[model samples]
Target: NNFSKSQSNFMDTMLVFSSGTDIRNLRQISAEIESKKGALVENQYRLRKSEVELRRKMRDFNNMKDDAESDPFDVEIMEIEIQEAINSRNGARTYIEAALKTILCMKQQYDAILKNKGIEDVTEIDFENEEEEFHIKKSTQQAFEDIVASGRISVGNNRYLLQIGIMPNLVHDYWIKFLGSPNSYEKKKFDEAREALYQQLKGSAIKEANTRGLDELFYENSCVRIEHRK
Candidate 1:
């Protein structure tokens, strides 16, 4: 149950985080590398909040410890010492709860986005007419060109995206099956793709990791975009 639940949550997180950047950087670009959603955003916030709590607690704790050293038998020092731990624990619990809630909220949001985006089958997707796109180098395009191109794909310049040559569901399932952990494996595979890409692009100017998930396919320089059929 834990494995299945974890896998499901991992997929959910992937989709949720894939919604793109925060409000500050909302414009779609072709250079995005990682997909966003769960641990990426949620863990980041949780870390920041926890850091603040920890710093505040440590400062207060250190001050109390100093006071205790000055008055070794002070009863108030003992009380303060206990309270400091309690405060830290309380802060951590609050952050944990908030992080969990944020994930739950993202789950709801992603599901809604899928429905709204008309992603009938999360597997087969067409890049044109789709707002999101994941760009890749011309090499990755060969695999895609053979299978997905079908006269429906377009190639562009500065192409250095690790696109979803296969749909998210397929990619998601494959990672979980092979590596036994979706989150960790997906990131690992992404890294692998980078290694492969680097070798492929040797002597070539390093291009950005450009990608924007779309509901359909379209054209832009050498970037190849393909459309999925119903």
Candidate 2:
């Protein structure tokens, strides 16, 4: 009987121990499940965020595609307009250059005529004696006055006139002196200086032409060859 009673007490103690172990295992399983649920929720949130960003990018790309399709000729039209502007600029430049060349030729002819008439200095010429022959016409003077009053003598359309107007009288005096120089040494010095200036201008023009990728043959054909008088 005592052995039977002892065995029953030992069995009761073992059952309580087993019950405590089962409770601890259950708590651990519940904690693990809660942790897994939290991780799944976070992953789902990240996935939704990525999906939203992808949709936004796709929408932007579609909008850009629609815009491009709506105006397929936009780029071509811009190119044509740019080409037209370049052509217009080139035409204006050519016109201005021609006008300047004409003016320079006229001035050279006038200087030659004066030199032939034994006029060394235009400023020293007796204007009173030749007033009837070379006086400015009233109509011409009035037109000049009107143009000045209208402020039309600008660098754009009247660039040649502006250049002539801005040049000092001393320039003409110096040219006259150089031309009437008695010594061959002075004439040679002036010729050398003029040649140097021409070379500098030619170099600048060549540099500009090269930068624009102009055809060498076309540039050479367009250039006026200078003939230096011996």
Candidate 3:
């Protein structure tokens, strides 16, 4: 019964990824998308079950009218529980919505790439062009990485920032990334440039007791990590 309810809800809210343009990859992409959407619904179902249980306890307590009015402490605790449950349910819904949007964006990008390659009706010439471009891009990225490692180029003074964004509380994965490249700092000017890029951001920015604790600063910023290749 719960599974049926979740399926119904999932189908209603699913961000459609199909465009009917490319028949070759549609089946595979559609299956994967459906699986991803199903997992989200399953997560929501579990969260809502806990919420319903909390609400039931509140209801049962209220049914005992005399006891409910007499005990103020327990009643207050139940009220807090109900509020938290409401928050949890709402958080799950928000998470599902965001995930769907992200999924849709990724699918569009995938379709665009596929169309650019002209793989809808692939030919020998198309395969040759793809192979040539792949090697060129790969070699270019490798060469760029090598140049950055040489330390001959004066990279400038800059601070390395780690930004993290948490959503759906503990249920979803926390997004973490470097705000900018640590290599942007000049190697000659900054003595710590070589090691700072790897070592400086290892510990927590927030001071407590443990200087080793890194997770403490994760929720400080509501930011998503974006990569920019120069």
Candidate 4:
């Protein structure tokens, strides 16, 4: 009977040790997951920054291409910057993918530990759509119409103004008309003039729209339309 109790005690002690070890491993893995998520967020930021820079550089290059005063060396530098930004953005995407894989493996291990312990496994999820509250009052609708009428586009945390890729008739009718002019010399002048006005609106119309209360959802959709126009 004494030998039996001893054996049972030994088994119970081993079980406790195993449980403790598993818990410690879970804590370690959780820490690693948190670290990896932070890295993923950083990479996302880098990707956006790189994309915005590349887009700006390309626009600048296009606008300056026909300018008599624009230097070839400067254009070459812009091309190099754009290429470097592309490489950096691609590297950020690769890092994010690798980080996701590592985190996924760690999560699987964590889940396995939960199953072994007979503990309920809980998973947390976040949705981008849930990030912002959508408010669509009548005034907000009015503001959205105001923005649409103005042909203005804006985005970012504080709603900084950005240029629409495709110019509306309200904004660039003259450019379209000039491009289609019958006189070859007029078309040539229009081409060489570098029509810098077509690039983007100078200021955010969002603030003006905000007076009537801009519909956040509509604003987001409008921004999407502006982004995909070209």
Candidate 5:
């Protein structure tokens, strides 16, 4: 029962950090999107205003050209003004299109992150409560010990454990403790340990998927071999 409790606590702690970090990221991205949208609207307005000015300039040039008494120099200046207006309008239009593309890409990212978090709406996020809930009360050393005791570091679960649980929650200090003293040798050891864990987990997950007939859903390149038992 104690082991189970320790595992539960470790997972809860990891989840708090993971979920809270994602929500915070979503909020930051939302703010950026709104700011960009405002700029896009301003640019659009400028483009429209430029179009009106261009039309008015063209009309002025036409009227000046028809006036026989009008100075030749003045008519030439009007033509130059109309050309400048056309350039300005074109630039504004190009900028607006590019801004629109950027916003579309950002929105796609926002949606992807939202789906990963299993949240439908950004409006539902409560930042104040999220911070309070994710605040870790335990010291780094204690948390590390809890992780070691969790017994969740086995095959088929490292994908979640490493990617979602440990990587998000652990800092440099935690890694130093985890992988041993900082040195080239230690780094090599760390890499080897990680790769070994990944291979074990991948194989396990693939086997489980095959047994459940969910291989295609989970993996695109998994090879299934028919075992002939004689």
Candidate 6:
């Protein structure tokens, strides 16, 4: 959205510059966008690494499941592997979903530029429409792992109360929250809740939780700190 807004500003600058308006502001904005472009690229690269790791785990699980008939313990171990693979897969999926937004945002930015160039209308661009897949059995187990891993996943009691999985309640909540919101607000809420989740994902929880509301770092205690008065 910011990119699109900036593109609009670029159009305005075209007229303003011709009428003796300075391009200094436009230059600054362009530089800022360029810096953001670099950061987004870096993030995309990191996400690709995560994607590769997840794909490898998925392959490992498939191979193990294929070989599960060899031993009694093999099925059990393979199931565990499958569950881990699901977790990694979901994590990577979450990252990809977030990154796709950037791509969409960039597309809009480009579209906005075109609009200013006298384009009448724009087509709806689908930057990401493909849904991620998970083994149904594994996903059924994901709720439990989420509860086990995070100690949260709320299940609906209004149903049969068939006792679906361990911490069934939290699992439902996890799925609900995951599907319900794609905005940064939900991401922040998830981060806050994750602070109290299980230990395995503490690193991820903290990393996400640490993202600030603004680019500026707020320090409570520092050599030089700025205090805002109410």
Question: Which candidate leads the pack in TM-score?
Answer: 5
Q: Cα lDDT of model 1 overall?
A: 0.42
Order of models, best TM-score first: 5, 4, 3, 1, 2, 6
**Residue pairs in collision within model 2:** none
Per-residue alpha-carbon lDDT of candidate 4 for residues 73-155, written as tens digits (9 for 90 to 100): 99899888889888987777777777777667667777887899887743221111321211111112223334445633223
Question: Backbone collision count in every prediction?
Answer: 37, 0, 1, 0, 0, 9
Best-matching candidate per lDDT: 5
In model 2, state the lDDT of residue 203: 35
lDDT of 6 by residue, 1-230 (tens): 24222344445345422211112322333444466666667756765776676677667667766774667576568677657656765555554555455445544554555566565433212111110111112333445345545555434331212221123354456555544566424646654443333322223222332453332222224434568999
The TM-score between candidate 5 and the true structure equals 0.52
lDDT per residue as tens, model 3, 1-230: 23223333345234343222233234445566677678778868867886787679768668644573557777777778777877777767666766576457546655765788665544334433333223322222233343456522112211112111111111111111111355345544232332233232222234321344553433323343657799
lDDT of 6 at 140: 33
**All predictions: root-mean-square deviation over Cα?**
19.0, 46.2, 20.9, 31.3, 18.8, 24.8
Error of 5 at 93 (Å): 0.5
* True lDDT of residue 72, candidate 2: 49
Q: What local lDDT score does residue 14 receive in model 1, on the 0 to 100 scale?
A: 62
Poorest 10 consecutive residues by lDDT, candidate 4:
130-139
TM-score of each: 0.29, 0.27, 0.41, 0.44, 0.52, 0.26
lDDT of each: 0.42, 0.39, 0.44, 0.51, 0.56, 0.43
TM-score of 4: 0.44
Which window of 10 residues has the lowest lDDT sum in candidate 2? 131-140
Can you rank all candidates by lDDT, best first?
5, 4, 3, 6, 1, 2
For model 1, how does the per-residue alpha-carbon lDDT over 1-230 read when each residue is reduced to its tens digit? 23212335455446524433222112221112123334346546655765676677667656766774656555456566557656655655554555455455555554565566665423212333233222333333343343333422233311222333333333223323433435334656655653454344442222221334342243453364567699
lDDT of 5 by residue, 1-230 (tens): 23211123234234422332566656766776798789889989999999999999999899999999999999999999999999999888877776666566667767877898787865432553343223221222233344456623333333333332233233333444554654325546655544443333334333444566664322222333548798
Any runs in candidate 2 off by more than 4 Å, and if so which? 1-70, 133-230
Model 2: per-residue lDDT, tens digit, 108-207? 4445545666655332123322322121121122223334456232233233322222222332333344445654246467545444333333333334
lDDT of 6 at 24: 30
